[model samples]
Target: MRKLAVIVALTATVFLASSCRAETVCPAIAQASVVALTVAPEYVSSVKSIHLKACQDGRCMGADLDLVPGSTPIDQGCEPGSYGGDGVCSATSSPDGTLTGMLMLESLTASLIEVTVTGTGAAGQPLPVRALAFTPRVAYPYGEQCGSFITAGVVLDANGLRQAA
Candidate 1:
């Protein structure tokens, strides 16, 4: 009975520790899509994205959105695309298309992600992006196939977290 009690206690302790580990703990590396959306030509003026990766200790490598590519041909008149078919939806983080910038992961939770942008353009201004919070996460409902490159089907703030305006 003594041995059984000890085993049960040990198991309980392990279980508790595991449960505690489930709490939010920053990872060694992570990625977030900080996109400004609803852009014309590519996206339906409703999709955007952002990206970042942990590079070194206390430092990270950031990425800017490739917005210039948005000049690509786009069909303004959208239609219901096949969910499984290889539709025209596309996205790019090149330094020219869409509104994107460097991504800095400050912290993250199951429902919330804190990040900042340091590249690309926000409202035509070469402004540095502040660490924005993805409360409940930013998701776009109006998604098209061909616009992924420009729309990227991603997001940051619902109001388009751009710099100038």
Candidate 2:
């Protein structure tokens, strides 16, 4: 009886430790607020394409998000489509040449990285931008529950945090 209890406790301890560690590992999160690509004098455009990558934890995922001229629902792509329907993020461009994009970010484990802009500038010229200024939405004090649900914003009761500059 004593031997059996020892083995059970050891197994439980290992499992719990592993689970907690997995829950704590955070990925990178960086969002692009303004995007401007000026390849040359003739190539000067306000909007092009947006790309975001979640990098870290031996994982890397990116998508060619859509760019619009105004604010819209980020969940618009919850449906199904290819060109004009499905996308990861929605960007709003200002007349002064500011691009503000939003991604709800289901899981906020530090993942919003690698912003790339690729598209044609004015006069139908190729303009690819791999570097731009990005601002990471200030991460809040977060905790997960059962490793699937979070004890934070949605289900968890905690005062939400504000964005960092």
Candidate 3:
């Protein structure tokens, strides 16, 4: 009886210790925001193409943007399509020129990920702008009882540049 008890206690201790050190994999969240803007040429009119420079961390295998109401994730190789409607803006200028629009991001799970704009500049002049950081909540599976968390923000020049950012 005594030997059996000792064996059980040892097994329990080892089990508890191992379980405490077990690795837990949590979903990763990467996000960025627009802090400031700088317009050059002074007289540059009609919005063309907007460029947002962003930095990201973690394994973002793929990414997609929710530009239109029912727009789906298209191939990264193709040029980013237009938002609003078909006949909205006809000029080919900087899209980020205006700072009023929706920017949606989708990525795989990560432990800790964040994105931010490093800097903004024209052809040769660097502009002064602030960095925006955001932490997105995990999106739960559908019909699984848990509610899904959606992170929505303005699509800045940084996001339009890279995949992670």
Each candidate structure's count of clashing pairs: 29, 8, 15
Q: Identify the leading candidate in terms of lDDT.
A: 1
C-alpha lDDT of residue 129 in model 3 = 38
Q: Assess the local accuracy of residue 145 in candidate 3 as a C-alpha lDDT between 0 and 100.
A: 49
**TM-score, cand. 2:** 0.32
- Regions more than 4 Å wrong, model 1: 1-61, 68-109, 120-126, 136-165
Which should have the higher lDDT, number 1 or number 3?
Answer: 1
Give a tens-digit lDDT track for model 3, residues 34-106.
Answer: 2122322231232233333333354222122222221223333434446633333233333433333222334
Candidate 1 residue-wise lDDT, 37-113, digit = tens: 31333332333343333232244445544443333354344345689645565553333244433333343223433
Most accurate candidate by TM-score: 2
After TM-score superposition, what is the CA distance of residue 43 in candidate 1 from its true location, in Å? 15
lDDT of 1 at 100: 32
In angstroms, the error of model 3 at 74 is 29
TM-score of each prediction: 0.26, 0.32, 0.27
Better candidate number, 1 or 2, judged by TM-score: 2
